[model samples]
Target: MSDNLARQFLLREDVVFLNHGSFGACPRPVFEAYQGWQLELEREPVEFLGRRLHDLLRAPREALAAELGCGSEDIVGVLNATTGLNIVARSLDLKPGDQILTTDHEYSALEKTWAYVCRKTGAEIVVVKVPMPLTSEAAFTDAIIAGMTERTRVLFLSHITSPTALLFPIENAIAEARRRGIWSVIDGAHTPGHIKLDLEGIGADFYSGNCHKWMMTPKGSAFLHARPEVQGLLDPLVISHGWTAESKAPGAKGAFGNSPFIDEIEIQGTRDPAPWLTVPAAIQFRKDNDWWGVAAHCHALAQDTARQLGELTGLAPLSSPEFCAPQMVAMPIPECDPLVVHTTLFERYGIEIPVFRWQDRCIARLSVQGYNSRPQMDRLIDALSELLELGAPQIAAQG
Candidate 1:
């Protein structure tokens, strides 16, 4: 089954691609659908972009909203999670002495975005260190909530952390933020198809996620979601045609007839909506392929591999199984140069994975998709054994 699924992806045959969590690989059918949209746009540019774009864009948003369990009007397509997050970070009317509380495990790009926002707005960023080897959800939630104070304006967090690949229990924290009048902005870059999502149930003031990562859409497909009551607070990153005087008025409809939240951010400028349009095809692909079953198989394989690596390196996992990502694991490694480990794995073994130093630990983050197989995992283990000089398994351990 894994071998058959591998053929559907466009990944290179020579490389053992273990980095699906970084930028997802689009399946052949979905990529074809993406190209079809691009062809349609080019064949009749004016008609597609001018007369039909508003309606054309609506279908994908509705499809995505259904999957995310949110109102279609609350979510708008954006280039990536980072772009969607930037739209929210910049739009907030944060004042001097205000603080944005966030975890240390956030994606670096978003950290930089908040820093830029801080420089301009005089808002400060407060980092909370999530305890290592996270085994308790209550502990995780408590740590985040404890970070908030009188001046904490926004509670920024990753639904699934990028570097560590831990699935944070953010629901309680989000609810607490709402109670305290601190806006909750969730970065769901590794969420979406990676895990079950209910944006409305989560009740965040703002949320953003990438379809390109877990939804198997082409690059440049992502979304930002804002609740209806707070939609007026956001100003679009670009003051495009969607920003009508009427949009600013309370309870007024958008210039494009959609809600101001959708029209203002989605209708930014002339750009390829092909990737965004391919979202339905991607969602359909998952259903047709029984992706939940595939995901389960991938998860078992990923955890098994993580177990093997942990035994070999004599290093524990960053989190317990319940808190770890379903299909991605950040395996702790013996202290070494991260760059050397990454380069050697790629150059010598033709294995593509992300190895990096996150604070005190060296990590090799493994992402298992439907296409990955036991042999590829074996190859990774073999390579790492040679690289790290760990001869054999010390003792097989279970989560």
Candidate 2:
């Protein structure tokens, strides 16, 4: 992609940073914009968040909704996708013995959310294992659909997986869920700026994504989009004024549940909404810099990086090129201590990347951004070759 752009990220100067999927690298300009919003919030918290809050949020929400292809009312800013998913998982009146079906590719935090919801209600978590070397989108959809049953009340899938970095054809699965009246809750953590999303077109009951990941905003910026009909199904994690019969929305006096319009969870006492407010600045930054083209270029580089790394390491990829995300790729590494390698790369070679163990594998996930360049990838390749092949010998001898 654009090596110079990637260079703008404030990392240890010597490090060849590749792990954008974990938290995202904010461009210098976007970060400055973020700080500006933070300053604005600090300037007059009451005027910014209390009185003129909705008005300030409205324009940004409209802009984001237009980009995501949904109505502005359908979207609500949140801390992150984890909180967003919790709002949906806890809000929905999942019955005893109800099942929440999800793929093996989900982020661990959300998996815990599903487990928590299951523990509260007598619900079952049906985690479908998607085999590696993914052939096509149909193979994935078919496996997930095959797992569905009468008790399957929910279909929870990731837009782009955390560990595997593959894009699941969740729309097709959701279409089938609609036929069976199953609630679809999509965790789109890696998809906001990485891939094109049409929340309305996907027809998921509830979908949440992070701007801090792919959109390159300050951390703690994310959004949840819920269909109006099912919006009432959400119960904000915190109980507040919206819980009382008198305080309920116009629909019912005894509603006593999630107020979609005024999410009480949002009023969680007090915190910084600076990152959330920076949504417009982040989006505008992308607009000012031809983001779609940046995405396409990043995608190509990700594929290239995956191939180079896979060839160098002699490891089988988690998924085919067609199924994987353009921004990030996960290639399996030797089942060694992930921390050792992660630290080794950073401390020794100055390569900033995520090396973590997941599903009995150590995945090296590299995030391609506009700032990354061919030389950076080459540096990664050379350093990893040294770490895995040449360096392994010496490290073992020392022991």
Best by TM-score: 1
Candidate 2 Cα RMSD after full superposition onto the native fold (Å):
2.8
Q: Which one is best on lDDT?
A: 1
Task: Tell me each candidate's TM-score.
Answer: 0.97, 0.92
Over 4 Å off in model 1, which ranges? 390-399
For candidate 1, the 10 contiguous residues with the lowest summed lDDT are 390-399
- Residue pairs with backbone atoms closer than 3 Å in model 2 (clashes): 3-372, 5-371, 6-371, 15-350, 91-235
TM-score (C-alpha, index-matched) for candidate 1: 0.97
State model 2's lDDT.
0.81
Q: Score residue 167 of candidate 1 by CA lDDT.
A: 93
| Model 2 residue 131 CA deviation in Å | 3.1
User: What are the per-residue Cα lDDT tens digits for candidate 1 across 1-399?
Assistant: 457889999999999999999999999999999999999999999999999999999999999999999999899999999999999999999999999999999999999999999999999999999988899989998898889999999999999999999999999999999999999999999998999999999999999999999899999999999999999998888988777888878788878998788888888889999999999999999999999899999999999999999998789888899999999999988777777778879999999999998998988999999999999999999999887774213211110
lDDT of each: 0.92, 0.81
